[model samples]
Target: MTLPLSDSALIGTCLAATALGLIVMTSGGGGAAPTPDTAAQTETAASETAAAPEPSLPFGAVPAAPDAVDPEFGAQVRAYLLQNPEVIFEAVAEFERRTAQSQGDMDAALVQANADALFNDPRSWVGGNPDGDVTLVEFLDYKCGFCKRALPEVKALMEQDPNIRVIIKELPILGPESELAARFAISVLELAGPDAYDSVHVELMEYEGAITPDYLEDVASDLDLALADIVDLMESDAVSTVIEDNRALAQRLQISGTPTFVMGEQMIRGFVPVDNMLQAAAIARQ
Candidate 1:
């Protein structure tokens, strides 16, 4: 797969994310309800609304007031924006100022880079191999075809390199199928131990298409594991918690898709080249 968007990518993604946020806010950010106003309704019927939190909106803050532009025009803008606001002029200017300042702080942040403190703990990536030196975290979707294709590479890494610890992170983003598969995967891990985790991991990844309860059962049967046992595990609070932990970690890592890798201090998101991965391992060892 293609490399995820980095700095520049983040900019566009953040903007798009902001736009979507605005839509949601307009729908309702959960503040005081708006009253019918001349701007929103005809002038014959005016209404008032408490200040809305438009932070989620693109550019941040509510849009221009009707009095500032044409009284009528401003009212129209305000009416729409109180519901749907854009930073436009003022917000853009401020966003640039604050953003530059935030950028300037990066150097200080980098200076305190706690490489080992940050990465050594597997809990940082959810339940991972805390003891392994070359810790490899894989963000995967159970329903992803590419993830299935990538399973062999992952299995080989663990089998061949004892020191190379691999953390299988479930990032089910395809749909509800993905989520259910993930829930089931966790249940298998809890009941079957690490070996079961390995078996289920490989089987799910190796198998293709929209994963379901049936596929899970089929795989379980092949592995001589009972479907009921796994299904019961799926309902366990601990299993759900682990999946939730994985989801939270993925968000913190800014992981956008499946097959992302974190080995040593470097994070290689997407399908990493074998030689490149080897090089990263070498660096970690040194």
Candidate 2:
């Protein structure tokens, strides 16, 4: 039997033990004899724990207790995620923030690069008048709320500046609805003329919330346009091809959002003031 050490002695003993541990850890004696066995055992245990996986959805964040889509699948996913819900959520948020930030940074860099490729492509710019002195290229989605509100301003800009041409590149990076609407709009461009495209463009932007097939059809009819023609063209691969092209260009240019404007060499984003646009357009003419 051993007598209990004084508190000071015990404290000194702990520090010595810690120092010894540090020495062992740093000097490679950590892997000697039984230490190697323990290290391997610890590594194996960690590997197994990683292999086993925690709950996927994390604690309390599982979609539903009894999932309709394969009960086993939900359970397995949740189990894979485990009690790390906060970690998962934070990870996702951090990823999005980082990705958006990186994209924003890359966008500035890419826009400055010599045009080996282009965001809208030089051909899409052809949508504007062939000989127009000033070209205004817009990277827009049909579903963006801000784009709709800015329609009057867009129209005003177009009206005030006749020589200023607008290139409406259907960069539908928002969601499925945005893509569909953009496709439909492009098809409508084929069905009708620039007027119809502009009318439909303005109308769709003015609409609030999610755009559906039925509402889209109604909007087309309201424009005194032929729905059958637009629908046929919308279903065609041409729309898909154009959108794919737009996505490629956006990826190259790093345009992640709607209503990004390229007036001459300047890349102005969002709903810029009309006065600012007027200033920019005037400068472009020069």
Q: Evaluated with TM-score, which candidate comes out highest?
A: 2
In TM-score terms, candidate 2 sits at 0.56
In order, how many clashes per candidate?
8, 12
Residue-wise lDDT of candidate 1 within 101-176, one digit each (tens)? 6743542243236334334433323333446677666778877776776766665665666677666767778888
TM-scores for the candidates: 0.55, 0.56
Candidate 1, position 98, lDDT: 87
The residue-by-residue lDDT of candidate 2 on 204-271, one tens digit each, is: 88878678989987897788889888888887887788788878877777566778887766667788
- Global lDDT scores for all candidate models: 0.63, 0.69
How far residue 105's Cα lies from its native spot in candidate 1, in Å, is 13
Candidate 2 has its poorest 10 consecutive residues by lDDT at 66-75
> Which residue window of length 10 is worst by lDDT in model 1?
42-51
